[model samples]
Target: MKKYSPELINKLTDKARLLRCHVVEMIARAESGHPGGSLSAADMIAALFFHKLRHDPLKPDWADRDRMLFSKGHAAPLWYAALGECGYFPKSEFARLRECGSILQGHPDMLKTPGVNMSSGSLGQGLSIANGMALAGRIDGKDYRVYVLLGDGEIQEGQIWEAAMAAGHYSLDNLCAVLDFNGLQIDGRLQDVMNPEPIPEKWRAFGWNVIEIDGHDMSQILAAYDDAGEVKGMPTIVIGKTVKGKGVSFMEHAIGFHGVAPTEEECKQALEELGCG
Candidate 1:
């Protein structure tokens, strides 16, 4: 668990805000891509990639680096923004997102992207990979940790529970999973679709150490992440409460914004709201 100085916290927060804007503009430029969930998860990803996770941009496969898997891979924009802005690649390449032959695809592919730990698109599978990595770390006596981000709606998949059970039973304490609890999925509200509430209790019942916090608050998000580092004998789950399309006025909590790109005007409004030009 690390205590970030005020300066570092502010730097990470600034990076997060920029990442949020990048997400919106990238989606708007592509005229396609998931924005709601990606925007919602930006702060947490920023906190991880900038301050919490231990990885080298130049050495993407560094043996001792912490691992992060995006379970809800539709939000690749946010992840790509973090990677590029944090110096994994030239930020200019971001404009080429989703283009033919571009490494930045609709979802993360470890083979293509320099910093992505794995190729992910299917729901409910990232945690399983995270668990495997944690187990391998244990067997090889490596100090690396594994983290995975899961969507609130994606939790309805039966495979998630199976992976949860396996992670708990194995006591993969080196593993941490975060739920992007924006409360909305692609179709509609999660409760209206399939409720994943009682989320913390459910994880605890499956033998994980659970905590809930505001996903957008840098302090709270950092605290939750640091706490995850201290849990020694159990997997940890941080249920991050967030609003979909958080920075844009019309998009917040709007299910229609889930997979849709914003208009040019909407992009201007969103960037303005984010305090950008």
Candidate 2:
């Protein structure tokens, strides 16, 4: 694995914290949004947008730019925060999240958003979309890679398995997916709701190169991305084990926060816990 310097790790760590703060504030402002999954996936998103993705914010539609898709699109707040922080759009747009005409919708909308590669909300479709993109890049002779973020809960959809089979069959080495494997979903814990355990083994059986890591660890997250790039014959899936609603004291692993936005008091407390109060 490629070693990352402490300075780079620290910078990405701080960026993840800031992104978490943004997720809380944006959801609170909207009065409704998914926070648990967003928080769970924040660190990975931070590593991708800041350290790994190769797209120009100024040229959101650059032909040869790398593509990042959010399969679990309810985590739009986290995606918006990353895009805004990376200069894809004005950070001021965060406050208007989920508003009637805001570009920052409850789920990603490629038509409205600048950096979004896919308009995704319904579960189990992102991998298929990513497959098409990866194949297109190959046909067009572009070197850009495609990355998709999948929720552990979302994988319960049978469509995900179909996409997995297809990706394995096609040998999509240019595609890499990160599973935000936080245990809790909106209904309850994944095991209680519908277990998708043995996740790594399942992906490996499907011909994917699996790399498991602590989702919140900056070093491991960066290292996983590096390792994915080295796999030549199949796609890679990093199953990042993470806690739902990370960073905030009250929200950590709290299923109640899955689809509910924090109130003023809760938001204040969450910001304080994140050191942004």
Candidate 3:
């Protein structure tokens, strides 16, 4: 594992802030989008695109490059920002979010969006897709890793468990499922909606190596990715305990922001709080 120096952590933190800003502003501009989940995933997304993922922004379809599937697809704004910031396309395209003819649609489309390996928004299905990709990679002897970011609530779908079981059965070590365990969903608290408690034990039971960490912590996030890479003979599932609508005073842990866009004033305040004022 590489050393996570204070400078590296600080850089990732700044990237997260920029990512958060993009998510917040884009959703605010759209006036009809999900802010909570996107904000919560900002740090992880930044770390993946800017550091962890072995992707080429210039060569979106380069063979042997790693793949990322947004299993929690409604959080498209976040991925759009990351892709843009990472140079898959210009970050300027973010202004066209949800536009009728914009490349940045409400949900990610691999055909429309460069660098998106799989078109996903349907919960529980992304992991299965990841498993398939991982299997294909194995068959081709490609060393590229497949990462699937799943929402905690999305795991409530039976397909997620089915995929999990398959990944474990095949010992798909190249497959890593990262859960955005923010503890809240569109309706309300995740526990109140449907508890996926004892999460670590459940994954271990299914033959996965679970690595729990503070999702917003840059150092921990990087360390977890390092650990995920070292895992062999079994898949890795990182349960990132995050806060829904993180970094925003009003939105943090607030279920209302789950699928609601922030107002212009709210966005201004949010950016100010994020130190981009």
Candidate 4:
């Protein structure tokens, strides 16, 4: 594994915190959005946008740029924040999230959004789309890689399994996936809703290179990305055990916050806790 310097790790860590702040503020402003999953995936997303993925914010449609597909698109707040922070669009656009006629929709729209590579809102289809992108890269002689983020709950969809099977069968080494395994979904705990346990083993059985890590740990997250890149024949999945509503004292592990946006007071508290207030 390639060792990352302390300076780099701290920069990524700060970036993740900033992303969380953006997520909370955007959801609170919209008065409707998913916070739990967005917070859960913030660290991983930050790592990708800041360090792992190869893309130019100045040229959002750069043909050879690496693609990022958010399979669990309810976390649009998180995705939008990353893009804005990366200069895909003005950060001021975050205020219009979910508003009628805004480019920053409730879910990703590739045509409208500058950095989003896929138009994804329906769960369980991201991996299939990613598979196509990866395969296209291979055929076009482009070395760009595809990265997709999956929700633990979203994987319950039958289509996710089908995509998994196809990715394994094709040995898509250029494709990497990260599972935001924060345990809880909108309804409740994943185990109670529909268990997708033994996640790592299941992916391995399907011919993926599985690397499990603490999703919040910058070191492990960075290392997992490095490890995934080295795998040659099969696709790799980094199963990150993350905390829902991470960085907020009250929201962490609170299932009620899943699909609900924070009220003004709650948003104040969350921003304060994130050191953004």
C-alpha RMSD for every candidate: 1.4, 0.8, 1.2, 0.8
TM per prediction = 0.97, 0.99, 0.97, 0.99
lDDT measured at residue 69 in model 4 versus the true structure, 0 to 100: 94
Per-residue lDDT tens digits for candidate 4, residues 124-215, read 99999999999999999999999999999999999999999999999999999999999998789999999998899889999999999999
lDDT of 2 by residue, 1-277 (tens): 5789999999999999999999999999899999999999999999999999998999999999999999999998999999999999999999999999999988999999999999999999999999999999989999999999999999999999999988999999999999999999888989999999888989989999999999999999999999999999899999999999999988998999999999999999899889975
Model 2 clashing residue pairs (backbone): none
lDDT for each candidate structure: 0.91, 0.94, 0.90, 0.95
**Which runs of model 1 end up more than 4 angstroms from their true locations?**
1-4
What TM-score does prediction 2 earn?
A: 0.99
What is the alpha-carbon lDDT of model 4 when measured against the actual structure? Answer: 0.95
Model 3: per-residue Cα lDDT at residue 44: 85
**Candidate 2 structure lDDT:** 0.94
Instruction: Give lDDT tens digits, candidate 1, residues 42-141.
Output: 8899999988999999998899999999999999999999999878889887898899899899899899989999999888899999999999999999
Error of 2 at 77 (Å): 0.3
